[model samples]
Target: MKSPLAAIPGAAILTLFLALVLALGSGFARAHEGHSHGDEAPAAPVATAPRGASSSSALELVAVARNGALTVFIDRHDTNEPVTDAVVRAEMPDGAATAEAMPDGSYRLDAHWSERPGEHEVLFEVARGGESEIFPVTLTVEAGAAPGPAGGFAAWSAGLAVAHDFRRHIAEADPLPLLIGGSGFVLGIAATLLMRGRGRGPALAVLVTATVLLAGNAALGAETPTPPGAFLAAAPAPSQDLARRMADGSVFVPKPTQRVLTVRTLVTASDMLGRTSELPGRIIADPNGSGVVQSSVGGRLSPPPSGLFPRLGSRVEKGEVLAYVTPPVQAVDMSDMRQRQGELDQQIAIVERRVERFRKLAPGGAVSLVQLDEAQAELKGLTDRRTALDNIRLQPEALTAPVSGVIAEANAVAGQMASPGVQVFQIVDPARLWVEALSFNARVGTRDATARLADGQVLRLRYMGAGLADRSQAVPIQFAVENPPSELRTGQFVTVLATTEASQQGLALPRTSVVRGSNGQSIVYEHTAPEQFQPRQVQVEPLDAARVLVVFGIGPGKRVVTQGAELLNQIR
Candidate 1:
């Protein structure tokens, strides 16, 4: 009762399987890279939210439409500061509506016309700071276009279903895969029947299973319209207007994101500004308010009467004794001193005996009164010299502070040998710091100068003087800090911007506003639209510590981002 397929060789079945696999692979390869076989093209990039922008000489206005509502943003044209209390009224084709000010510094209007898909002219009348202005903007609304796709598991599953359908369509369009699959299916069924021999029940079950599988695949591959109720309800999702970089190298930031980033802007304006030069400098102690403790002669360092040398950062007043320097006497010098002492002693003893003899003889008229007086004076002089020599050997030099300040440096140690003219301690007044900068130019202005620290802190400086001599091919200029902070330390590096007598006309912008572009050019972000920022390459020059002069590339009346520009550049 064995069927004819039961006698077929196993090698023949394997050969058919390999042929089927090769055919399907070749079909997939062609579909993947050769051409498109599906009806739907790949989805286009998601568009930004609909918006309109308009600006005038004094104010800038922008409107964004979302959820059947239109939100308007207004700011000052000069400073780019948000205008919170402005009254905004919009006149549209259907009707007129007044906008309510929101806490987020935006005006919201309930515009029923925004839901309709068409171009609408909007006249916005804004009044703030006792001034009123009218701005006209054209807004376009697309019909049946979702702001963005839904989120969560529903969206993910929907995306997977779409991909599956697209793959099925490609398989259907290519006939090679279908032909191979059908031939493989027939061969597999015939082999199963041949192996079953006389078992009719099992053979019938296999036929039914194979038929069901083939029908299921056919159903999945076919195109069918889905009912609206088939899908779960669209859940509440966050807005899709996110901050991203555009293809044109611009950045698109939504209003909400801007608020979170605390982005601020400034309207650039050109004016005649004084020229300035930047110089490398460092903080130094003021000459009049700083002091150095040193030994005039080689000596041993000892603590003051308080029994301790001043530690670093110790505060001391002027004339406060800090330490004592005991000069070491060499053996030869000691011997010489002893010899001088002995000689003085002998002289004093001899002079005393002579003076006594003269005094005693004066009364008998054998010696004159003037001679006795002179002999006594010689004895007094020898005694004074002997006493002074002994005092000099025992005395120690007391070192005191010359100015009131904190000890910035300390090299003193008890019983430590100190060389002459060697600095033992350095005292600096924290409140009286000076910045020394190397300036190549001679005619630097003495009126305005500033020092910028690494942490972006700026200190006002008063010009002291510039050295006539050249140092490192530059003149050394000294400037006294007007009000230095306590955290300032001597030897800390800084950038000194000193004003010059020359003047130039340019737009001055904050240093943070300028950033380096991908191409290595200096660029600044301009608020071109309500939620869009464009990069403008600019050439800059030194103006002051906090600002730079823009020579060109951007003109006046454009809003330039000041704060949060670095954050804006990171968008991708």
Candidate 2:
């Protein structure tokens, strides 16, 4: 016979062998990656119920096979929100089936083959509105108990059985098997070149066949429980009780769990947020609408005629008397007052007697009428002096409200002594409050300002005035609260966001959305897919009191977690 190497067309043979080897190699790689080698130890039995999951750019789907039925769940890929009102159909081994919408937002299919143990390929057709999608998923179901080799010898025995079954299938002349065999045979003939002067065709044939069989066996043996491309661990498949960090560093959170956490998102858009500078500020009473009730001189404090002092938070009007300050007299002054009262009393007694005598004498015509009139005048003057002395000792200073507002503070008792020029009560109109912010630099056009409270409350502000005098190396800028709430109090610390003349353009996000990553880099969780949040490193600038501008690392039109971001970071 002609030398096989010389007779065999090199191009045709090489092409055929290359095609087969490539095909077989890819198949083996995929199978091995997804499954397990027969020689390796079996994977641990899943501790939870059997489940099948599939994902697409638009949706994430999972189906759990349970007692006599199957439960399916579908969520929006970008938001991880459950997709209800969707008609879902499934292709099972038996006839086709339709899933019913359950009250729990899941689809339920009555499957008779739920208990079947083997590999199953399911086709899911989901339709909602004008959009439709198909997902094909392969699920493996094993018996409740995991199987193992009987002994070490049984491992080889099982391998042999697999090989035997493969050989039997090859004998059926399937196109795939025939192609592989032909490729191996052609390659054997091609090997004859190396043995040009020797007779080793039989050995070459055996070697080629062995190599091909070895490769095929490795691919065929990979059928363990675990599959490849598992981004998340499946060992402890709890019922969405927890959010977890996936292997690829994405956050996996179920819809139900996210809802319980009240997770919310914000749509991103770019805009020109005027340049803002944050300043340490405090809540101040509006100067025009608030004032203090104080004593001009040192005196005792006493409640007004309403019988009690104006309580804290008590509403009072302008010029309302809130307290009385009884100016206490010194011991020396009291003694002088007593002496003046005694002298006036002696004079009053003499004038009273003289007036009585004058009236009697005038009636008797024994005294002149002019004399009687003069005596009466003298008695009246003496009485006036005594009355004036009594009145002077009883007068008390009244403290009044200078502005109409609520009482913000009170420091008064019925007999409390109020020192000179001391504030006894503070009246503040809560509806008319102002924020005093300290700016490191004099900022003109800082007309747009907002005050953010520590508890996430925001108050709109109108630019008032900036101080010309630098206070503590900074200028004091005042802003009036446009619509102040009742909860606001004077002297409350706050943060002020003042818009300067400059402007910037970027994505504005809630400050809470940006969090510190493990490496201390600033990171924001991006809604990359449905039920997936990927931490993206970002460069952020202060946009305003409540929002920060994302200048780099992330772009626009993506959802960023505004709420529950801290909770999401704790998932690991």
Candidate 3:
């Protein structure tokens, strides 16, 4: 009853209606899909949208316009304290620029495109509050154009368009067109089988139609471009600007403006001399060549004939009198000495007269030869006792230096009374000093040793001996300084470096070259590209005073940031 041509138009209309429904369904599926794409929300039309504060506490930001310049203010999440003196950097559309923080925790910059229309994406890097936060905001300027319709068929169409865009973006995210193509091939087989009752031409036509649909889907999928946030998940390029070697074999550092940085360089060269082993050491006096001058007798101390008390660092010769000790005599001893002197004087007078009488009577036969001999011997003894009494009042014990060296310690005062056995001065030969260090390993027949002063001066050392006694789980190793300076003193603590028979090969770098990373790992910056620097972890061992032996993680001839390393680390 109905014409076949009439049915063809209806079937075509039905096919068009199904296609529209399928397209609409796909758009709805995409609109409901809820997943953020990188740092951006897929639903956000503008690339830069103000996100909810990720801070655990409060979020504060102050936007100020100063002298036609736009200034930004950021503070602590909770405390609202001004984050002054922070290193704030902004990623603008033009490029990166450092922002100067004002006194009130506000940052200012000249916004040349403030009057421009459209939404601008601003990325703020605020390094404060002991952490770094990236604040991305989209500022839309509505200079013209009224707000459009909020809801209606037009709004729905707009929403559909957005959904379609989202679906397209997702399609470009994966390779699913190949599966669709396989499905189309299977459909084509079914169509051919179903059309077997008809002519082969019709069946082939159906198969070709299915094949074309599959091919069209595949082609559309292949033509889709990647989404905006797809590249963010890719691997990042290595940072190579930290310690790059220059064209002239030197490191170029532009950190901290290169002015306030403390950068030092060491010129390298090779020479044929005795191998040196720098050791951490301290100044000490030679135990054998030094002595403390002490007062044995308790009495008032007086300067020697020089009339000047030996001060610290004064040079003194061996056997030179540093001070005099006047022994205080007791009253009983004084009385006894006086009585003895009187008795000796009287005896001397009596002996002198007896001797005279003996000499005269000898001629007259009044005295015998034995008596004259006894009288003369008594007179000689009396005269010796009288002479000793006179010398006792004028003499005092002189404290003399036992070593020829500088005065390492001088506790003497001009009229101060010194107790018995109290140390008055310590004389040490600074030129011949020694250093004592403790080593956990037992050092036997040490081949070499060295001492490094705190002022960066190196001292040559000769192995002296190692004590058998243990001190703090370590053996004491002593070394004699080859040629010490005048500044060396006794009882000064120093580190001693004693080399064993073992040897190791590695690149030795200065201690300043190594810096601790934020993750508590030891890292060193390696110069890779011309303007890029990457961090490399390293294992270090103590080599000497100023240098450390990099036992692992770094090769020779690599440009490392020896100077201005701290400044380079400040880069975000």
Best by lDDT: 1
lDDT of 3 at 69: 47
The positional error of residue 453 in candidate 2, measured at the CA in angstroms, is 2.5
Give a tens-digit lDDT track for model 3, residues 1-572.
54323323455535533553444334334433433344342332222111112222334443422222456655443223345667777776667788876664457776554445566677777775587777765555434222233346345545555654665565435334534554455445644554444444454455456545644543444443334333221222122123333344334443222323543323222222222333334456778788999888788888899899988888899989999988888899889999999989888998899899899989878899889999999888889888988667667889999989888889988789999988889887777777877777663447666566666566677888878889777777778878677666656666555555555667677777788877887777664432345677898766555566777888765657677666666654
lDDT computed for candidate 3: 0.60
Writing each residue's lDDT as its tens digit, candidate 1 over 75-170 gives: 776556778988999998778989999988999998777777788899999987788999999998766443445556557656655666566566
For model 2, residues 1-572, the per-residue Cα lDDT tens digits are 66645644567456546655765555455444553234433332224445687878777788777666778888776555678889999998887989999997889998757677788888999999988899886767767412233355445445554554454343333346645675666555647644564445554555456457756654554444222212122223333334678768899876556756656676688898777788899999888888987799898887789898888888899988988888888999999999999999998888889888888888789988999889888888888888988877698888888989899999888877789988899988888989998989775466768878999788888988989999999999999998898888889999988877888888999889999989999998887654568999999987777888888888887878888888888888
Counted clashes in each candidate structure: 0, 2, 11
Q: Judge candidate 3 at residue 309 and give its lDDT.
A: 91
Which residue runs does candidate 2 get wrong by more than 4 Å?
A: 1-104, 112-242, 335-386
Could you tell me how far off, in angstroms, the CA of residue 149 lies in candidate 3 after the best superposition? 41
Ranking by lDDT: 1, 2, 3
Q: Could you tell me which residue pairs clash in candidate 1?
A: none
Please give the lDDT score for candidate 2.
Answer: 0.75
Q: After superposition, how far is residue 258 of candidate 2 from its true place, in Å?
A: 2.6
